[model samples]
Target: MSPPEHRIIAGIYHLSKDLGRHFSLTDINLQVTNGEFVFLVGPSGAGKSTLLRMMYMDDRPDSGQIVVGSFVSTRVTRRTIPGLRRKIGIVFQDFRLIEDRTVFENIALAMKVTGTPMSKIKQRATKILTHVGLYHKRHDFPKALSGGEQQRVAIARAVANRPAILLADEPTGNLDAVSTRNVLELLFKINAGGTAVLVATHDIEMVQSFGQRIIYLENGRIARDHEKIFVGDVRDRMDESRVSRRAEQLSEYDIRDEENE
Candidate 1:
């Protein structure tokens, strides 16, 4: 075999977006060596998404050094976004699947848009769908599937291109306990196969259960970085009570509270 690939991503002095102001990612250096599974944890509105967005070129940093594999993302042009996107897979919590399309079609669409040949599309799509444990549901549409299944289809579509890096944002937010375990197991398998994985999530319990290396952000900067710590039994981090729902709704009012003061 040829020589092994070196580090997949490296960044130092990253300064990106903030809430209507500049944020300092300066002295914020990190390195993701090949085959590493890393977690990016933080509170909501703490720039976790913004940091991840910079990696995929959805948002550019004001000034920073970023290198992904061989591509210098901070210096790349807009024309290179498609190419970069093809090389990195992203799993979104909202499951950005097409409600109108079947699971197989949704996965196939990515390859097709990238100009993948028709002959190879079906083979690759089928393989990845099976990899994400959705081969049997290939004919089902997003609306027909459970929250977990829909997220699985999203994962399938993301990894269809066999990207070098996979970025997942709150992937297990809506999933049940069993589904969460399955999804995390699947991610572990992917990481074991030499893909660099980075996950941004608020599922503290799941993160604790899995015990992976974690980088936590607070108020737009890393607050505490910790090694994977297995502290307790697996637990559900979300609450489905009406009070929680009401509290979520109260965020709007809470914002008003800040304004009133």
Candidate 2:
């Protein structure tokens, strides 16, 4: 008999949060499994990031049972957070790399804090940097690298310790076509490696192109959730004149017809 997969199983039962006297999340429920790549789509102020923070254990829900993997997150003690974090990776919209740290140091810092051996730290950092295609910029500081490069460095740091789940928020925001493709491709590779990835982004077009299991939020509720095929015709005809204006840039990086592996 085979052992169970190390799945990042999540169950948010009636999740809610207090924000200036109102509940940010209104009874949210969700679940995911290993090797699953899920996308979260919603407009600004929609509770996407708040939900992610809860999953990452950064913020506790006001009322609900939140569980990830085998741990109960709702009332998880402070002493156990570090251990829980070791099993999860989180990427932010701000690209939270230390401005003073070089790319290699940024990646190594995660393991260093966890008391990883110095010998293994160097090897692990280098491998993740190469994995994200940032080996050439390993010596550069965050301020010196472009937005996309900095984000890749952030990704390398997140994956350096080999996390079971990765939660990324607006990872491709403000990136050019090429940079977005590169970063998303790196994420796809990570997902292929069996790490569950959940990315929150509002790029509807990109969402349509990537074609993954999506959890769409609206007014603090689960508006839509499913894996759907990318149909360019509907989108193109919805706003014919608008799409025509942006067709050149859109077509350059569109992956609507690409065969999913």
The numbered model that scores best in lDDT is 2
What's the residue-level lDDT of 141 in candidate 1? 91
Score candidate 2 by lDDT. Answer: 0.78
Each candidate: what lDDT? 0.75, 0.78
| Candidate 1 wrongly placed segments (more than 4 Å) | 1-6, 10-12, 21-26, 227-261
Superposition error at 101 for model 2 (Å):
0.8
After superposition on all CA atoms, what RMSD does each candidate show versus the true structure? Answer: 7.2, 7.5
Model 2, range 1-261, lDDT digits (tens) per residue?
897575546667888876444536787887878877889888877878888888878888889878887678756889988887888888887889998999999998999989999999998887888788889888999999998898898888888888888889999876666566667777878987878888998766666555578888887888888863553332233233332334547565465545442
TM accuracy, model 2? 0.84
- TM-score per candidate, chains pooled: 0.80, 0.84
lDDT score at residue 104, model 1, on the 0-100 scale: 90
Q: Which stretches of candidate 2 lie over 4 Å from their true place?
A: 1-8, 21-23, 228-261
TM-score of candidate 1 versus the correct structure, residues matched by position: 0.80
Cα lDDT tens digits for candidate 1, 164-236: 8898988877775556666776777788777888998875545654556888776666777776565432223
